[model samples]
Target chain A: MSYHSAVLSGLGTYLPKQIVTNREVAERLGVSDEWIYKRTGISRRHRAAEGQATSDLAVLAGEAAFVSAGMRHVDAVIVATSTPDHISPATAPEVAARLGCAGAAAFDVGAVCSGFIYGLATATGLISAGIADSVLMIGADTFSTIVDPHDRATAIIFGDGAGAMVLRRGEATEPGALGPFDLGSGGEHSDLAAVRDGGSRHKRSTSPDHEGDYFRMNGREMYSHAVEWMTESSRKVLARTGWSLQDVDHLVAHQANARILATVAQRLGIAPDRCVISIEHTGNTVAASIPLALAHAARAARLRKNDRVLLTAFGAGLTWGSVAMTWPHLDPST
Target chain B: MSTILETATRILVDKFDASAEDVFPDAVLEDLLSDSLDWVEFAVAVGDEVGTRIRDEELTDVRTVADFVAVVEEKVGALK
Candidate 1:
C-alpha cells in the first residue's frame, strides 16, 4: 500500500516591525559592530513590541499560511517553539483558535532550534497515519521574552519572529513532498544550552533577581555540538533519501550563527554558495528560523520548484534533526 | 612513536593552524588560540586525535598549552 505524503502547500512568516541594529547592541554590550558582525554575521534583527506574546506571533504566521492555502480549517496545528505564552498550556491551541482552526489537533514541539524539523516529522507522521489531511505547522518564538538584554552573548543573537507551512496529504512522488527525517537528541549535553531553573525540576525563587529566569547558553560548547549534530543528522537523512552532498541545492541549516554555519558546511564538503545565509539579517530566531529562511529564499527568488533542499538544525534539549525535500512553488508574497 | 604532547601539538599546528614556534609547555593558550572559543575548538581537535570527547569542565585549569596537553594525555592513556 502507498503511504500518504505531507506535501507543502503554502508558506508564510511574520517578523516584528522594530529592527535592532548591531551598532545599538554594541553600544550596550561594549563591543564593536565589526566585532559582532565578524563573529555572528548579524547586522540587524527584529524585536517584538512590548507585551507581544509568542502565541501572538504564531497566530499571525498561521493566519498568513491559512489564508494563502485558502483553508478555513485544518486537521492539525503543530507549533514548534521554546517560548510559550504561558507555562501551563501549550501555545498551539490558542494559535489554532485565533487562526480559525479551532478544532485542529493542536500541540507544541519543544525542541528549540530543531523544533521546525520535529514539527515537520510530526505533521508528516499524522498525514501518513491517516490522522490528519492537512497540518498547519508553525515555528514561532519571541526569545526576547526570556533572554537577558544585558547579557552580551545572547542579546546580540536572538530575534523575534514566526514562520509557518500548510502541509496537505498527497502522493509520495510529489515535488513538494517531504522525504525521510533524522531526529536525535543528547540529554547529556542539555546543560550546554539551558535556563537551569524555573521548570518543575527547579522551584522558582521568590527573589526578583533570580538568574534562572533568563536564557543562558554555553556558546563554546553550543558551537561545537551544533556543528557536530547538524552535520551528522544531515548525512544520515541524506543517506536514507539516497542523496549526495552534491545533490543539495540549498543547505538550510539552522541560522544559529555565521561561524557555526560556515563550520558545518565546511565539514560536509558543501560549497559556501549552496547554503542559505538568512542569519545575516534576522540573527537566530530559535525555532522560527528555518521556515523564515525558506520564506526569505522564496521571496528573493533564490528557491525554485523541485530544487533539492536539505534542512538541518540543532538546539536546546540538545536536539537535532534533518529533512531532505525538493523546493515548493511559494507565492511571491511569501 | 609520537608522545601525547607531540601528537597534541601536531594537531594544534595542523588542524587548527597554530604557529609551531609559539606552542610550548609554558605558552599561554589564549595567546596561541586567540580566544575562549578557540580554546573549545582546540579541545575538540585534541579530542578527535585522542579518540575521546573532552568535557568543558576537563579544561578548567587549562590556561597553558601544557595544561591542555595534560588533559589530552590523560584521555589518551584511558584509551589504552
Candidate 2:
C-alpha cells in the first residue's frame, strides 16, 4: 500500500509580550472598541518586544519543538514567513544556527498566512521523496514591523508571533500522520491584499503617492475573496482526505479574524466547538497563526491523540491551502 | 452575597460560557474554565460594572476566586 511518510512529532509556539488593546487603538483612530470587536472579534493583539526580530521568536519555537521531539537535529528546516530578518540570506539558516541545528538544509518560504501548511507540504515531500529523513517547520513573522503605526486599519489587525512543528518520517498508519496537501493560489487578486510599497514593483512604479506604498489593502475586496477561497480550499482538502465536517474533530485555521472563521465554519457546517479560535488575543499573525493555534489547542486540552484535525489558511499572494491529519500521541514537553 | 459576586459571576458566565458559580471568590483566573481572552473580557466587564479597571498585571499573583474578591474589595475601597 502507498504510505504517507511524515508525522507531527512535536509542536511549539511563541508570541511577543506587548499587547495593543482595541481601546488603545480606538484612542488613536476614529474607531471604537465595539466597532473593532463587532467587525473582527479581536479585543487585543501581541506585538513583538522592542529589538525582538522574527528570527528570535522562530528560534524559541524551534527549540521548544526540538526539545519536545527529544532530538537535537533534523534533516531540514523550512521557515515560512513574509517578514524575513533580511533581504539576502534565508532566515531559516540563522534560525537553525541559533537552535544549534546548523547542518540541516535551511531555506525560507514566502507564502504568507498559508505558509505553515505550505512549509508542512514541503517538509513532507522532502521526507516522502527521501530527500530528508525529518524536517523542522517554523512559521514566524513580525507583522507589526511592516505595519504603519498611523494606519489604524492594518495596525490593529496584525501581530508578531511564531509557531513550529517537528515532522519526522513515519508510517501512514501512525495516528499523527499527515495526508496529502490541498493547495491553491490566485495571483489575480494579489492586489486585494499586499504591501503596496517596498517591493520591486512599487520601487519601479512612478506613483507619486509614495507613502501609500506601505501595506495598503482593499479590505472589503480582500474579505470576500478570502472567504470564497478558504471555503473552497477546506472542502477540497476534506474531500481529498475522504473526511467530512463530522469527521473533523478540530478545525485549526489561521487566526485571521472571527467573522471569516465563523463564516467558513458555518458554510462547512462544522460545529463552533470543534474549532480552535485564538485570534482574539493574537490578532492575525500571518504564517504563525495555524501552528500557534494548534499549540494553544494542545495546551488547552482541546486536542487529544488520534483526533482528526483540519488546518486551513489563506493570505497574500492570494495563496491558500488545507491539510488533514490525525493528532499524534506524544509528550509535548518531551 | 450583596450582589457583588453575583454581578461578577453574571459577566464571567456570559463572556466565558462558564457556570455563574465558577466565578466564585476562590476561582483562579488561569485555572478557571476559561481562556486568556475570556479573562481579559471579564476584567473589562468588571471595570464597566465597578467603574474601575483591573489590569492583568494586578492579578498576576491571584490564583483563586478569593484573590479576585480581594481585587474587587480593593477596587471598592478605592472607589469609596
Candidate 3:
C-alpha cells in the first residue's frame, strides 16, 4: 500500500498514405513556397486517401500502442477527435473492435486541438477513480476532410493523422509518472477560429448561402491567443508540479504551429533545443498533434526513461490545455 | 465562367467522394451528402474560388445544384 501515479507504458502513431506538399498546395492556390513555409513551418502533410476514414487511422495507432505497452487489452479506451468518420456511432467502439478489445468500455471526447490533453485528464481520472486500472487514450483527426482547400491560410495548416498512449496504474512516487493536468478555455474567443457553418448553431440561417460552412480563422487573432493561453497553461502546470522551468528535461508543446511553439518557449525562457517539434512533417494534426509529437520524440530518443516532460495544446473551440509528466521507460514500437 | 451545375456536381463528387450517379444535380443537399460537414467543406471549396462569402444564412435553401449555383451566383453578384 503505497499510492502510485499513472504512467505512460506505450506510444504509437499512424499517418495517412497520401502526402500533400506545400508545393502542391502552392501550385493550386497561387501562393509561394516561401510564404507557406515561412508562415507555418510546414513542408508537407499526410492526408487519408479518399474512402479511408478516421477510425482506420485510429485503429492502427491503437494497435501499435497496445503492442508498445505490452498488453493486448486495457480497462478503457478513449478516442478524441472533431472529425469522426460517422456521426451516429462513436469511433471508440470501432477502434476497440479493430484492437480485439471490443469488451473494453469505449467512448469519444471532443476538445479539438487540446483533445489529447483532455483525453489524458479523463483517462487519468478513470485510473484515480478506480473506474479503470489501465486506459488507452488516443488523439486522431482527419482534419483535411474538413478544410476548405482553396483557403491557403488553413489548407496548409492541417492534415490527417493519429497517435495513442497506454496509461497504466502506477505509484504516484514512481519516477515515470504523470503529474497533475492543467486545463482551461475561453468560449468568448470561440468565434476567432471555427468551422462556422457545420454545427448546430448555424444549422438554420435565414440566408441561402453555404460559405459559412467552411473553417474560418482570424490568423492574427489566433496567433496572439495561442501564445497567451499556451504560456499561461504551461506555467500553471509547472507551478502545480512544483517543478521549475529549468527542471523540465523536455517540453513537448502541442504541434499546433512551429511559430507558436517558438514564441511560447521563448516567453518561458526555455532553450529552443529543449523544445520538441514534429509539425514540419505533420502540419497541424489538430487533436492528434500532442500524441504524434510525443511518439516521434520517444522514437527519436529525445525522451528517455525518468526524463521530465510537459505537454500543451490550443485549438478551434478556443480550447487550450497543458499537462506535466515524466518520461516512462517503454518502447515506442514493438 | 463555369456552369453552376457542372461546378456544384463536380465539387459534390470530388469532396464527398460520391459517384456522379449517386449525386444528381437535383439531389437534396442533406440527402446526397453524408453530413453537414461535407456540404460545408464543399461550399467553402467552391466559394473560395469565386471570392464569394457564402455564409450559413444563405445555405438554408440550397438543396440542388441549381440551388447551390443560384446562391453562389447571388453572392458573387453582391460582391460586384
Best model number under DockQ: 1
Clash counts per candidate, in order, are 0, 9, 13
Q: Write the per-residue lDDT of candidate 2 for residues A104-177, one digit (tens) a residue.
A: 89999999989999999899898898888889999999988878777866876888889888999899879879
Give the top-scoring candidate (TM-score): 1
What are the TM values for chain B, all candidates? 0.81, 0.77, 0.80
In order, candidate lDDTs are 0.87, 0.80, 0.82
Candidate 1 lDDT by residue in tens digits, A1-334: 5679999888888999999999999999999999888778899999999999999889888888877776768999999998889886999998888888788799999999999999999999999999999999999999988888889879999999999999999987788899789999999988878786778877685356878888889888788788778878999998999988899999999999987887788778799998998998899999999989888888888899999999999999899999998887767233
> TM-scores, in order shown?
0.90, 0.78, 0.78
Q: With candidate 3 superimposed using the best TM-score fit, by how many Å does residue A100's alpha carbon deviate from the native?
A: 1.2
Which of candidates 2 and 3 reaches a greater lDDT?
3
Residue A201's C-alpha lDDT in candidate 1? 78
- The CAPRI category of model 2 is incorrect
* Candidate 3 Cα errors over 4 Å, as ranges: A1-4, A204-209, B1-80
Model 2 off-target regions past 4 Å? A1-4, A204-213, A331-334, B1-80
Cα lDDT for residue A249, model 1?
A: 93
Candidate 1: where are CA atoms >4 Å away? A332-334, B1-25, B42-61, B66-80
Instruction: Write the number of the candidate with greater TM-score, choosing between 1 and 3.
Output: 1
